[model samples]
Target: MKTAALSVSSEECFQPGLIPRSPRLLETLLANLDGMVYRCRADAQRTMEFVSEGCLPLTGHLPEALLLNQQLSFEQLIHEDDRELVRWHIGECLRQRRRFDVECRIVCADGSVRWVWDRGVAIYNATGEVEAVEGFMQDVTERKEAAQALQEAERRYRSIFENAIEGVFQTTPDGTYIAVNPALARIYGYRSPEDLIVSLRDIRHQLYVESERRSEFMRLMEQHGSVSNFESRVYRRDGDIIWISENARAVHDDAGTLMFYEGTVEAITERKLYEAEIRHQATHDALTGLPNRNMLHDHLQRAIQARQKGSMTVVAFVDLDQFKYINDSLGHQVGDELLKTVAQRLLSCLRDTDMVARQGGDEFVLVLQNQSGEAGIAEVMQRILAAVARPWPVGEREFHITSSIGVSRYPEDGKDVETLLKKADSAMYKAKEQGRNNFQFFAPWMDTQVSNRLDMLISLRRALDQEEFRLFYQPKLSLSNGRIIGAEALIRWQSPEQSMVAPDRFIPFAEEAGLIVPIGEWVLRTACRQNRAWQDAGLLAIPVAVNISPRQMNQSLIDFVANVLRDSGLAASWLELEITENVVMKDAEKTVATLHALKSLGLKISVDDFGTGYSSLSYLRRFPVDALKIDKSFVRDIARDADSAAIVKAVISLAHILNLRVIAEGVEDEQQHDFLRENGCDEVQGYYFGKPMSVEDFTLRLRDEAIRGAAGK
Candidate 1:
């Protein structure tokens, strides 16, 4: 740092203790001063005329050595590098008739360099002849070094500010740019900092894509004195959007008033895009490219919450029919294509606000929202069904597809995601039961049915393990001679915790829950053993009919029945397996083969509920069965319903034409029996003969009937 020398009068120079005759006190003060005090001749050498004792430390020499020319002159004491500079400053000050104030390094007696400030003025004689110069001299080496260090720090900081990669900026509180680095100009797509500063004057309105972002930045700065990683979308000079994060603080003046904001900025657009992709993968199904279960759960929960605000939300569980068979037959690659196609179809049937998520496999869950009755839910379902049913061509083959959908409404069918999904699933099965290719809304009754079915399924398994089941027989009497020729064994469940559960209450459920297969085997083994015991006791040789469920028939029925009979030591002829008419027609060829296999083992086969199925004369002629039992539904209306009576007669005639003995079941009155007897029905089994009874009761009845027949004969 340098400063201009001030004009100084002769009196001013004398005031610094340069009087011609100094008092003792003034002399002492001059000798004790912090710096060298001197009066020198105005000659070229500037030979010292007077010198204070302080010069000993300032120049590393005794006062006597410097006075006059006894030792090296003060002019020689000035460093070689600064001698000309010092002389020029002093000469310039003298020409201006002012004082000289110059800083230069002076060499000490030990040859060490020290910086000093020299200030002096010329003294004139009474005739205006320049006499000598007098003033104070101070050693300022430490101050000079400190100033040099500060200048070096400032230079390095400026270099770094120009070259840093991160965009650095300083702006006033009112959003005017005070300064910006070159990197900031490059990031914002400007030619230079000058171009950026001039073109983007209003930071609030011009820089940010979202108009309020700048305001938010200001607010954070106001509240916390700083904003770290404050991110936002911003517009570049070319109007392209980019993401940025800023770390800034409000710069304050000494009195704590905000002056400006300074910060560093980073472009984060690519990082933001990558993070979005990760989030999408986490929430979406990979195969179908639809929302996965994780997303479904979150979306459904949000919809359920929204239901509180008077808006309707529907959850539809869609299951593709025969998907497993198709997937297995065509391979997983085709299955994946099928799923992808169905997902697109489902999406087409829905609005942008609606969600269709792939729950997994062949199942998808749909969420429909804000459906006003004016714009019907049924209409949406119809569109979806039609979309799914469209012909899907895979390679050379074009195939038609179908789906079963169950709908559950928010705040009505259910109030939560899990409950709605579960109920919708149950209703989807009901759609399948109603013959597939349709949709059904969840009903309250369906819940009860589902709950009861679940409880019965658990109970059924426990019943098998605990022996809570027993078989009761209903006598099948011969219409020709009033003889007991056969008895149908009906299962009765006597649970330890509840009343006896009739077969009708749980039999269908057992079949659905896949519990009937094992239950059927248990019935077969138990009935065989009991029949063998009855024959050993010398009772009549009557076949006991154990009804086979459709589920059991699909399994290895022939082997299971043969195993039971062999184990029981019961002849196959005395154990008839009764199958429902519908069960036989399901897969007639397979059923026929299984029946023939059983017959070769000497077991008789009877078709139960004979009149209530897809029964054809050709199929009947083909079935190698011993008898056809008429379903109780028609028999219940036999006397009054002429159509019922006509149907019954036709069935009997059909059975006889096929050489199958015709039996009428569910007879509850004498009128029904008399009608069966006169109509040529070969056998009758009903409550009229006797309601289903225990084994002991059946034995007693057989003995009583035998006694009566003998007496009548």
Candidate 2:
């Protein structure tokens, strides 16, 4: 490593102290040399002639130990495995008369191996036979390790790119595939990455289903420098369409020059199909495969938004008349088939712009858009009436079905979905009232009727909670003795705002609103307790008859009635149930079973409003009843109308023959009373005996009767 004894090539590298000023500079430069400078003989031992001070640190040995093989030859410093390689390389370089450059590992004094770069040229005698060699060697372990690590990283990246599940790609900004991994090729239905890159000369035109899709992707990349979850439809190599989502970023060089777009793609066709199916199931009816109520609302709202000034959006609420009969007689399966058939017919009656949705069983809502006027709507309505009315054959029978349609026009009848549907429903009911197989246009006046009914229903719900309901007792008199036999319980509502809400005004509404059951139970409970109260007051006990609505006549009625009597401490014999004839006749078998069950409890059962319904003589014979109350319609006219008199007389005769008592109601005057008494009616309830009165007034009447009886005795 000593430069002083070497033949100097550079002018500044001279022997130490040869020039007084340059010697110090030369010594300083040699002392700071990065590696060991040495001279060795071209021999098997490679004996070192001179070595620099850096040899101690570079080879873990002093220059004196290595020079002239005083301790160990420089050849021994070479790793055992690299000794032959070093010798052969140096010999070849010398024979070629060139500088030798090689990288070899050397064993250090501490047993640690170090990578070294040995670079030097050989100097020879005047005959050109190599005489000696000079070289510089530096530790290169860090650089070697770094190069090895780079090789491993490249290998791992290639593996991932080849086998990744998601497609990996790099494409030019102008839409040509520059590089693609195996996964990308597979996703695009290509044989290999090379094939994919070669085939997709124009990525946008060949891959994207929409020609403008690539333009949008480029625009997004330019705006944001990245794109995430960019979903689009694209064609595969086989020309089949598939959905794909891409996550990508624009790649750039260090100078911020645009390079290419690199991204990952995920095939999502199956996910897209699954989501679409879920949406379809949500918006469509399972039974009829038509749009359901939710879809109807959505469609109607859209129609309302799209409705223009010169045109109309018509909403038609259609109801199949008496469809329950079909479901009750046949099965739900047949009913479902019929509904589907009706849906098709309804669809056929409208333009393509119109939508028909199943609101529910036997009911459909139609939204017709862009209609010119009532004439067009009317024409469509007529078509629906005829189409739905056509005979539908089920199994062996051909059944005729009809629909009642209610029409509401946008901006005229309503401007919102709820309002439009409600008005349409109101008109539909009006259509049914006018008679089925027809359609009705919604008028402003219809809202009045609908609102009143709705208000009355709302009030009825609060009536029980507010204690606004009262029970009035109308005395039933025995014609033979003219004494109170029993009193019928009637409900009356006293409203602070409307004075009095009559039974006829709210009872029917209460029935439709499912409020009748609770109201009916209250009446029964109150009447039973009142009859027991009269007996406690020392008055004669008589059965207190409370009317039973059809809705109240469920399987639980017997238990409810028994519980009421038990709670009131009233004997079963002291309560009578008066169900309307129509309720009893509606389902004869069920009515018979219920009536007999009540009769078994020792309470009297009677058909109220008799001679008013279609009661088969045979069914009447089996009814478990103690009496029949003649309807007021016949009784009111008995004195003036012969048909009414004959009908009344016939009902009494029939009751007598069946061993049942006959009571006539609405007998207001002498003639009506005379006719009933002469016809052998057992009891009468009318203004003649007494009108329905408050609890206190009725108690007074009962007390007076007891007083009169005592005086007579």
Best by TM-score: 2
lDDT of each: 0.86, 0.88
Window of ten residues with lowest summed lDDT in model 2: 3-12
| lDDT of candidate 2 at residue 136, scale 0 to 100 | 91
Instruction: Evaluate residue 66 in candidate 1 and report its C-alpha lDDT on the 0 to 100 scale.
Output: 73
TM-score of each: 0.51, 0.60
lDDT of 2 at 153: 92
Q: Which ten residues in a row have the lowest lDDT in candidate 1?
A: 1-10
RMSD of each: 15.7, 9.9
User: Candidate 2 on 605-667: residue-level lDDT in tens?
Assistant: 988888765578999999989999999999999888999999999999999999999999998
**CA lDDT of 707 in candidate 1?**
80
